[model samples]
Target: MSSATIRCYIGIGSNLDVPLEQVKQALLELRELPESTLIQHSSLYLSAPVGPQDQPDFVNAVAEINTHLEAHALLDELQALEQRHRRVRVQHWGPRTLDLDLLIYGNESIQTERLQVPHPFMTERNFVVYPLAEIAPDFIFPDKTPLSDYLANCPMGKLKQIQI
Candidate 1:
């Protein structure tokens, strides 16, 4: 963790073990992360599963936070949250009790064995893009493209906003 606060974005999703409840509970926990403050969160959106269609659709949202934790430390906190929610990774993009992805860490572009800031698939997934754009419309990617540009490419035809 660092002494300086850093603004970060996180992608959240769940489709098992009462998906909506999982998201809601995770949000509550997120607000209490050590050295972190959850600034804002986007409305939950229902989206089709990215992998096997045999599972339930996902409930997704993005959260913005200010934290003293560095990128990797933030990721550790997110994973711990997921574990608390009983998340299990049996398959890629599979159904879970909760999933937390560190989408961006300030202006950093990180690629380590354990984490990747500016999540690799955020721009391509409406689930990630729409919520992110909703809260941080002015955010620019590490590539310098505005967040709206990615949102434009993401079609929300199948993504439905969950009435909170």
Candidate 2:
């Protein structure tokens, strides 16, 4: 592995098949990823389904990692981990066993056919903002704004911190 390591943040969420356990297991698996050092994780938060409200609420959290792997490689690894837990992408923002999102990779703005760094909605949603800010309060957005500001602006409706 290279000596270089970028600070990366990932969003983890689950609402099906023992959702709380799924997030916890994913956190442990994240620490075991090759060539990566698990930094820390935020406390889990419960949030209403962002899309269709018919499904169970989601348990969400964020993780910080120091990794030698490039952005896309890391994304692939996350997806593989989700697949290991039997994640099913049946509908847009639908319920799932696990959902992992690459939020930021050391200030790099990445756009590809499969991934988007900064996570597109990281700045707006309470589920993303609260947990991410909890882990990386000083993290800056692509547009040169601090994460805490976004977390503060997010509406605190259905998001509640929960131990999982």
Best by TM-score: 1
Give each prediction's root-mean-square deviation over alpha carbons.
0.8, 1.3
- What are the per-residue Cα lDDT tens digits for candidate 2 across 1-164? 44688998899999999889999999999999988999999999999998899999999999999999988888889999999999888999899999999989887898888988878987888988888877777888777988777877888897999954
Instruction: Give each model a TM-score.
Output: 0.97, 0.95
Which residue pairs in candidate 1 have backbone atoms (N, alpha carbon, C) closer than 3 angstroms, thus clashing? Answer: none
Model 2 worst lDDT window (10 residues): 134-143
Query: Lowest-scoring 10 consecutive residues by lDDT in candidate 1?
Result: 148-157
For model 2, the superposed segments whose C-alpha errors exceed 4 Å read 1-3
Q: How much is the lDDT of residue 77 in candidate 2?
A: 90
Off by over 4 Å in 1: none
List, residue by residue over 1-164, the lDDT tens digit for candidate 1.
79888999999999998899999999999999999999999999999999799999999999999999988888888999999988889999788999999999988899899987788888999999999989988998878999888877778879999998
Report the Cα lDDT for residue 65, model 1.
Answer: 98
Give residue 95's error in model 1 in angstroms: 0.8
lDDT scores of the candidates, listed in order? 0.91, 0.89
